[model samples]
Target: MKQTYGYQQKARQFFAVLLPIFITQLSLMATGFFNTIMAGHISQQDLAGVAVGVNLFLPFFGSVLGIISGLTPTISQLYGGGRQDKIGFIVKQGFYWAMALAFLFIAVGWLAVPRVLPLLNLEPKVHYITAHYLLAVSFGIVPIFLAGVLRNFIDAHGHTRLTMCITMTSVPVNIALNYVFMYGLFGVPAFGGIGAGIGSAIAFSLNLLLNVWVVTHIEPFKSYRIFHHFPRPQFSEWKKQLGVGIPIGSTMFCEQSIFGAVGLFMTVYGTVVVAAHQAAMNFTTIVYMVPLAVSMTLTILVGYEVGAKRFADAEQYIRLSRVLTMVFVGVLALLLTQFKTEIAALYTSSREVQPILTGFLVYAVFMQVSDSINAPLQGALRGYKDVHVTFLLAVLSFWVIGLPGGWMLANWTAVGPYGYWIGLVAGVLVGAVCLQIRMGQVQRKFSGQEG
Candidate 1:
């Protein structure tokens, strides 16, 4: 009876954290979803331009986001260890990292996009719009990074609901702005795909401002005075964070870049293929928010337990997290598989795009399962600060194995786009298997140390 009660209690706690974060993540993803859908309405070429533009930014943004997320485990550990007072200083350092990354992305966007876009051999119209879209969105890089830092800091203290409120609020704001800017509502000039980028920049700015307000003005966090005294960057602390964050960031860069490469590959097939790929990818990304949320919560929960020196409890949290993730993703996968055609149609009315979208989604269903397993396992590994091996495995699976196989199959085989997706599935499966194995090793190591 006691064990059952404990299980129920743990499940409840997990959901309490997971649900808000889930909503928050969904809201964040909605920015891209709205962009794709709105751009789809403008024209297929516009949709393709937006898709490529977003993919171009994704690898960099995802890497920096992962780097900032290192703060989650750090703050959670501090909270668990009763060292909450030090969180202010750590958070300040994170802001410094955020600023540095923001500038780096801006520089890359300016220098790289010009050189890289033409190399894709995209249609001239599509290429022009993509460049404009990226230019507009680059302005938001700082706000986006800063928002991530604040969200991670707050979430680590178990205040996920605040972040949720902030993000959820942004959805309506983003959607409204997207409609206004994209369609030229209320006498504004229509910017089409570029308008989506503008909307996102405005939305991210609002999100960062709100996060700053809440953290500085709210009761629980205000006492920490995180912004009261800005400390100079401590190289040692920065190095420590970079040690953990760089691997996490690189892992994400590998994973996101693989998909970005796939997008670039699809462009060679034509605009319709790229738009169809966007539809399929956008839908799958929405579904992914669920598992991603649960995985993030696991990081915090496990980090807290590890910091408290409760290795057994931390292991238990991992088990509970995996079970919850499986149940949720299983049901989601089943629904997506069963109704994929109908769902694909929702993204675009273009007949050419719908069939291709549906086809890609069939593969996406299996990818979802592999993704579900891999995401939480990676998060659990992050909690243990066991990141380096996972990074190596990710490179081997996604780059060394996955990308090469995908390129060959895509270029040389009859399977074409499906071949690329098959490569994605293969990569994710390997990553899932390898990550789980590493997690086991980490658990045993911790167990031995505790013993």
Candidate 2:
């Protein structure tokens, strides 16, 4: 019983750490909102094109980020476990891995883009717009990779708020650039949909620049001389990071691959449903940041606790995290339910889009619980380095339960798009159950074995 308060103290400390991290996550969500609003201002076709462009590459981009993100937990563990010397070593490996990924994707993504887009069978106008948008957007990949190293390193050092501040600074700048580039404001060429991609590239570059600046000037990194400390990565330590990170990265790939599959599935459904689904998903993304941020914080907190050999403390932190995350998501679902039309209206001016989007809003409300439940357990499992189980489970639930079910309900039955979303509901429920079980078992193994 007394141990509970100890856990509470640890959780509160973790919460303090999370404030900036959550804000950083929220900044990312805000970027999506900004993109959605600006895209809507252009035209429905433009809006839909951008959505398709995003979905097409989302899995690959997610896999890259996941590969880099594996470092944050591993580095935190290195610190908490008192392997102070290995911190710089692991961070350098993360950067190298990110850099390598950046180069490989540039050649691969450019070639893949043409093949992937037409395969989706988009409307001509949307396809044309997406091709251009993707071109400009692709230029920012390496910069984003660089930013990941600095961002994750800072977060692992227990100073996440700095990244949030940099991201916050970038948001308005991105919006302004979108305005200038999209409409030829202030003597800039009006590239329209293509300009949106350029606008994004500009924003990403600034974010990378700012992250580097903070690393040099900020108290935490500056004091530590984080750059010099990592002049080179130790082979032994680098291998350890790859060992821990690769599986988690693949786990992320499994889930994102499913979304890519869904995007392909959406193609046969025609343009209107695809556009409406994009809008609804965009709005839902805003809600999703709530749990995503919370769960991400839980991962770091649990990782830190486990590292410090406070096994039970890690357990309590996740429980507290789940409770807090649920409260936020539940309230958000209620607000969206009450204001569905107003919410949908924010996406498109057309009456056609607004009505169909409302259906997606309804679905979003129900999906929040499952979404909230999934991230932390995934985080927890990653913390314990329990990769293979997480990977297999994600594949089974999303593909077998979600994708096939969505197909049967949508195509095989009369429900149409509802069938697909109903599949989403079932898949997430299964995901939540699987993740919960996995988290328990993971915690047990880590608690008993080493700590």
Candidate 3:
């Protein structure tokens, strides 16, 4: 009875933190879902264009988010240690890091968009629309980075409900703006696929504003005085964050860029393939949010336990997170496998795209289990500040092993796109195994056991 009660209490605590972060992440992801679905309505070319543009941008933007995510564990540790006074300093440093990354990405977008677009050899129409979309969305890069930093700070403190509310508010705003900008409603010029970019920029700007308001006015945040006095860049702190963050950022870049590379590679096969890939990727991404959220929650919970010097509790949280993630993903994979056709239809009305989408989901179902395992383990690793090994493994698994295998299988074999997906599965499985081993090493180290 005592053990059962303890497990129940832990489950409750886990969900209490997980649910809000999950909902917030879902709302954030909804922006992409809205963009993709609405773009699909315009034309298949538009859909492909939006898909390519978003994928191309993800490596840059996602890396920034991952880099700033280093702040979360740091903040959680400080919060857990009852060192609230130090939290403000860390957040101030995060802002500097965010702005630097934001500008760096914008510059990369300027140079790379022109050079990289031609390399893909995309369809002329798709290429033109994708370029415009990229240009427009580039405006939002700073706001997006700023929002990520704020969200990380809020989440680390376990004040996730406010972030959820702020992000959820953006969903409707984005959807409405997407409809207006995409269709040229309210006498606005129809930007077509580019409208999705415009809508996202506007929505992200609003998201930043709302987050700032909350952090400044909220009771929980007032004591931190994050905005009170701006501090100069502390080289020591910056070095510490970068040490932890760059590896994380690089790992994120590896994962997203490979997926983005897959999207680009599909363009060679033509629009139908690209559209099909987008539908499958978008749907799977939504499903992925479940494990992603659980992973983030694990980082916070474990970081708190570790900071408080409760190594056993941290280990327990990691175990519970892995079990919960696997179970949830297993159920989700089964459902997606069973209902893939019906689900594919939700993304587009085109008969051609639906069948291809359903086919892609077949691969997606198997990939989810590997993804579920890898994501939570990565999060648990983050809580331990064990980032470099994950980064090294990510490069080995995704770039060194996965990308080459995917390219060879996709271009050289009869399997076509299925081959690319198979490579992804293999890479994720390898990464999951590697990350789990690393996590176990950390656990042993913390327990003062020799490996």
Candidate 1's TM-score:
0.89
List lDDT for all candidates, in order. 0.84, 0.76, 0.84
Give the least accurate 10-residue stretch of model 1, judged by summed lDDT.
1-10
lDDT of 1 by residue, 355-438 (tens): 988899988888888888898988888887778997998898888878888888988999897888888888889989988888
In model 2, residue pairs whose N, Cα or C atoms come closer than 3 Å (at least 3 residues apart or on different chains), thus clashing, are: none
Show the colliding residue pairs in model 1.
none
Candidate 2: regions farther than 4 A off = 1-8, 39-49, 118-129, 229-239, 257-260, 263-276, 332-359, 448-451
Q: Model 3 compared with the native: what TM-score?
A: 0.89
Ranking by TM-score: 1, 3, 2
Clash totals in order: 0, 0, 0
lDDT of 3 at 167: 81
Structural RMSD, model 1: 3.3
Evaluated at residue 130, the lDDT of candidate 2 is 91
What does candidate 3's lDDT look like per residue over 22-41, in tens digits?
99887777778778888999
Tell me the deviation in Å of residue 14 in model 3: 1.0
